[model samples]
Target chain A: MNPFAQKKIFLEALQALRLKKKPKETATKTDASVCPSCKESFSKNALEKSLFVCPDCGHHFSISAQTRLDMLLDAKSVRFLNRRLQGGNPLNFPSYEAKLAALRSETGIYEAVVTAVGKIGGVKVVVCVLDSRFLMGSMGTAVGEKITRAVEYATHARLPIIIFSASGGARMQEGILSLFQMAKTAAALERHADAGLLYISFLTHPTTGGVTASFASLGDVILAEPRALIGFAGPRVIEQTIRQTLPDGFQRSEYLLEHGFVDAIIPRGEMREAISRLLALHGRTTA
Target chain B: MTTPKPRTAADRVALARNPLRPSVTDYIDHLFTGFFELCGDRRQAEDASILGGLAFYKGTPVTVIGHRKGKTLEENLRMNFGMSSPEGYRKAQRLMRQAEKFKRPIITFIDTPGAYPGIEAEARGQGEAIASCLALMSRLTVPTIAVVTGEGGSGGALALGVADRIFMLENAVFSVLSPEGFATILWKDASRSQEAAEIMRLTAQDLLTLGVIDGIIHEPPNGAHEEPASVYLALDAVLTRELSVLCAQSGDALRKSRYKKLRAIGNRKEAL
Candidate 1:
């Protein structure tokens, strides 16, 4: 069985063991603060059919990279790059590699990101999708290399590039090397920008840190997904440093758009059509 | 008693021989004869801080864009203390695009604290404005050169900095961020600006060593402000020579060389 299923079984057995000795605690009170939609929770299979959203309230949880790719790209158009690229425990931090291995086993993804050359609405472009499941989509050497290679490919082919960023920032295990990716990716985007090719960066929920400071902000037309968090440093860090409370909706996608940091805030459902319109505006077509 | 009389006019004339002040305006007028000053971004208002127009340097037509500071409070306000807004950058871009279209070699003189930081500026998309200028300058098909005449700070300098050759005056500094901002961000105190300045390695000599700048133009003793005329002559000579070399290349070669030149920056390190 997969690790996720095995872990679920282990948790169930532990709960059953607790239940066996709970005869005297049968009248125990339970918290009444559960999500209203989750109160009548459906089976996991049923949730999968609804895109992992809450059945009643339709609260959209995060989706996997594969699901996002399937929904975004043209049918059978994704040609994945760098499947063999994986992370390393360079810092020798305790249990880093073990944790990564367990995550790999559970998610079946090699890295935090997947890069591909695909067609979105018949427009040939390079697309990089960040998977939040793997280490919260932290950017490491592999992620950086994949992005740099994608930009290089787009520059060589004279094609537009599109990247959907959903990162928690640079990977800590990689140390300063992860920080260097900021400059590396910026330089790549510099070359691509110099080529007069369009680069559209789509910022998703929780985009922050070194990524926001680099190529993510270097887009010719920067678009953010609804309610995405985009900033160089977290509000808590800034507030702690400055010793002041932040304003409402600080660093949210709508706030950034209003503040002119992003060009527009696009909803996930309409992203493909919006991207197609932008590509068409640029007179770019599929190969 | 006879020698105690007031000195003659000759003594006063000899005393006035301070090397600091010279015939700077006269020399610049002669060297850059037929200079025409252009104004406005054509989209909105004009910025006095950045001056750009056609100028004849040694009988050759060249486009000159440089930051110009004022000597008085009113003029300083007019010039915005040399901190340009989006209009200023757009004006520079307009001249650059025109120069490229006309196949004329371009020379830009950079001297700005940074881009203007104001709520109105942000409302008009300052980052996007700078990004647009960078994009436009990078793709221009003309031979372009940038001379850091003074402070070269962040995106303000970078907007007009994409060129085949970058020359900086000896005392000038070019950096990603101002020393004060660097200090505040890295040290958590603005008082460490001097320390931040030292660590940033912003001097022209340092940048030359890092391959960030192509060459450094020697300034007169004390600085450019001391001998403005002699400095202008020296700058005019260097600008003429660089422009001549760049102008010798074809349009396609110029574009290719500029692209390669920009691509070659910041490629020195390996993973540590």
Candidate 2:
């Protein structure tokens, strides 16, 4: 077995040992959660307190955009931007409209990205966070427009910008129009940079594809959640293309930091504090 | 003298993918002198799909980059059938940055089906790599030109195509995605790709009319493959002329104009 696969088995066994003592930690407690990576179980409330990071193995679970906003921003602090912007089926892709409708109701997300003006550690900032639950947070025209507008908003306000990227890539259903967002968002960010404003990119679990290609990698300071997978392409494709087995822990945040792709691997628990410290250092303060 | 038979969008696609067509190497050999290839992205293994190098165009030193499509099956496999990986775009970015630093005029040839669509490519951040290239190319201070020599398919083509001036060969096709993909998605019939090709506004003439491309280079009676030497000569003259005109401008001017050009793409005013 692959080294990573073997490690996963060992972790499962260890977790089984812990579970043996607790007869109540059964499937009936489905509302509670288990870390797929470390196989450690926790009550949903406990996991929320931990910010969804697995305490034992440091695995970062995919958090919804709403949850992320709640964790990162102050109480009742968010003023959403471009909430009404949505993508039309430009290519008239069959079933795309229906799929969008289904996804909208299912995810409670209008689009893949949520752009908002919010307070983080009492510092005002514009944020565009990607919700992976919404079609894997694919970058469509609407998502791109939202990000660009948010960056523009930050530039105009002279406030800092923070973006949390979690995407599979350009929306396949949107066709080339979707791919073009990479350029659109990047161009907007370039103008934002011209204003000499600060932009922070927070990479969560599975930040890949066009999102990683553009604004995510263009941050003044880039940070990744602990053990988050951050890369342009996944390991399986790489392995298949090159016809070779990949090294253990490939494309993980720790591996990326070692390779100088990211500034640091920040655990979820310390993320708020870290952002606060960064904003303070940048001399950006709330009114 | 018979006029060149009118070609459909699907026919043009076939022409673009024709095995006998002149590849990037042919263009380099016929256009530039003292060509020296620079490989590896430095972050990962070298990607063979994108061929980037330094060469002297006419009497001036320049940087040349283009997709490398192979005519033979073995060579095509080696070059991933001209489909680039994340490392491929990164390698292009590395060279482009170098070009910007040295003030060398950058010329790129666009001819790819798209970036490789595979699990590993996505894992590696293929979209990010391509997006960075678009962002980087847009802001590069040096003069930049891109030629759509064949199939300018999706983000893969756009990666090298965010230039100050974009020109397409008479038979080349540039679209957001492959017609087959477009057809499959829109019509639920992949065989209706020909219909998608027509509706996509992807042919050189359509793109030029739409102002998506700056200009189009006229090919021979059949296509570029029918007369490679003449096609290369025509491209050479146009490149030299454009390079000289662009090179006369300040780097800041080039950067500003490039940014404006990219921003105006989907804008109502420009699209109108």
* Candidate 1 runs further than 4 Å off: A1-124, A128-149, A164-198, A203-222, A227-264, A272-287, B1-31, B270-272
lDDT of the candidates, in the order given: 0.68, 0.80
True contacts kept of each: 0.03, 0.37
Q: What is the lDDT of residue B247 in candidate 2?
A: 96
TM-score, prediction 1 = 0.65
| Model 1 C-alpha lDDT per residue in residues B1-272, reported as the tens digit of each score | 24555433222112212223222233336557788888899987898878888877778787878776555689768987677777887798889888887777787777776667553453454545665566566667788888876677655766677778888877677765566655665457878666656555567766776566788877665566576767677777887788779888887787667766654444334221
Top TM-score model:
2
Q: Which residue pairs collide, candidate 1?
A: none
Q: For model 2, what is the error of residue B139's alpha carbon versus the real structure, in angstroms, after optimal superposition?
A: 1.3
Docking class of 1: incorrect
lDDT of 2 by residue, A20-120 (tens): 43222223344778899978887764455455666568778898887788777766688999886787765555687898899899877789999999997
Model 1: per-residue Cα lDDT at residue A2:
52
